[model samples]
Target: MRWFMWAAVAGAVAAVVLAAVALMFAGGDPEPAGAGSAPAIPAATDAAVSEAAESQVTDAPSASPSSSPSVKPSPRPTLRPMDVIAGLHTTVRELVQDGQLKPDAGEDLTKRLKDAAEKLADGEVDKARDKLEEFGKKVAKLREENKLSSAGYQTLAAGLAQLAALLPSR
Candidate 1:
């Protein structure tokens, strides 16, 4: 009779230990004694394991920081007015080559950009600004006619506007 009682006590103790270990490993919240509720054990899903593995891989340190202060890259230098005009010319030529702009339209735009650059070089800022505005108007017309895609129109218009902004205000 005493051996039978001892066996029952041992079995009960083993069950309690197993439950505690499960709760610890399964990340479950253990219910308080006499709470009359069991701990909610999360099911070990493949997705959960995969997410944990991925997080560990991503969180692994790739490099150690140096004791020296970090240096930042320098800012890009601002473009000159002539450089902007030249860039606009190149952009127009490339668009024509890419079949995005018709040859005739490209030539007209290039001429305007070249003239503007020359005017800028001669200190005729207002004239250069006018030519850039003209180029923008032409781009808008092409967009309206559906000859230029919205993207193309936007690229050309933005370049023209930037060039104009670089010139002195009237």
Candidate 2:
């Protein structure tokens, strides 16, 4: 948890730095009052500098920050364990629907897992409560029955952990 907090702080700092650098490179023709901003000149020598900096902002709009090449969109979160679970759920569902996976308890279990993954992905915490609990039990049973490696179960458990991270405690 401490490590996560530190990482968050580091990420925020890095984002600020990158935003600053990107703004500097943009030279602020019409970016927001925050990013890509340059301190207003005294207005006396403005004409000369404006002309000098004019070429830099040609490709960028004089109003929209999105036009600025240096302005980056907000970063998307990387796919974590829950994301992996969603991908696996989608894959397994497709396979089962196509009759690739034999119909039986495995199909039912995979469907339940898929629903739980979907619920987790959708941030439907309450809706997924029972499903998540059942999925854990199912995964545990699979680990025991298949004699799967600790790592294999660890990966599945890691997905559950990611789900937990996304949810509010019951």
Per-candidate TM equals: 0.55, 0.40
Tens digit of per-residue lDDT, candidate 1, span 91-159: 677667666678888888888888877887888888878877787888888878866655556566555
lDDT (CA) per prediction: 0.68, 0.57
Q: Give the per-residue Cα lDDT of candidate 1 at 92.
A: 75
How large is the C-alpha RMSD of every model relative to the true structure? Answer: 28.9, 14.7
Give residue 47's lDDT in candidate 1 (0 to 100). 93
Off by over 4 Å in 2: 1-84, 90-106, 117-124, 147-149
Candidate 2: tens digits of C-alpha lDDT, residues 19-123: 544554465634445666677757658778888787676665576556546757665444453665674465445434543333464566677777876776687
Clashes of each: 0, 0
Measured by lDDT, the strongest candidate is 1
Top TM-score hit: 1
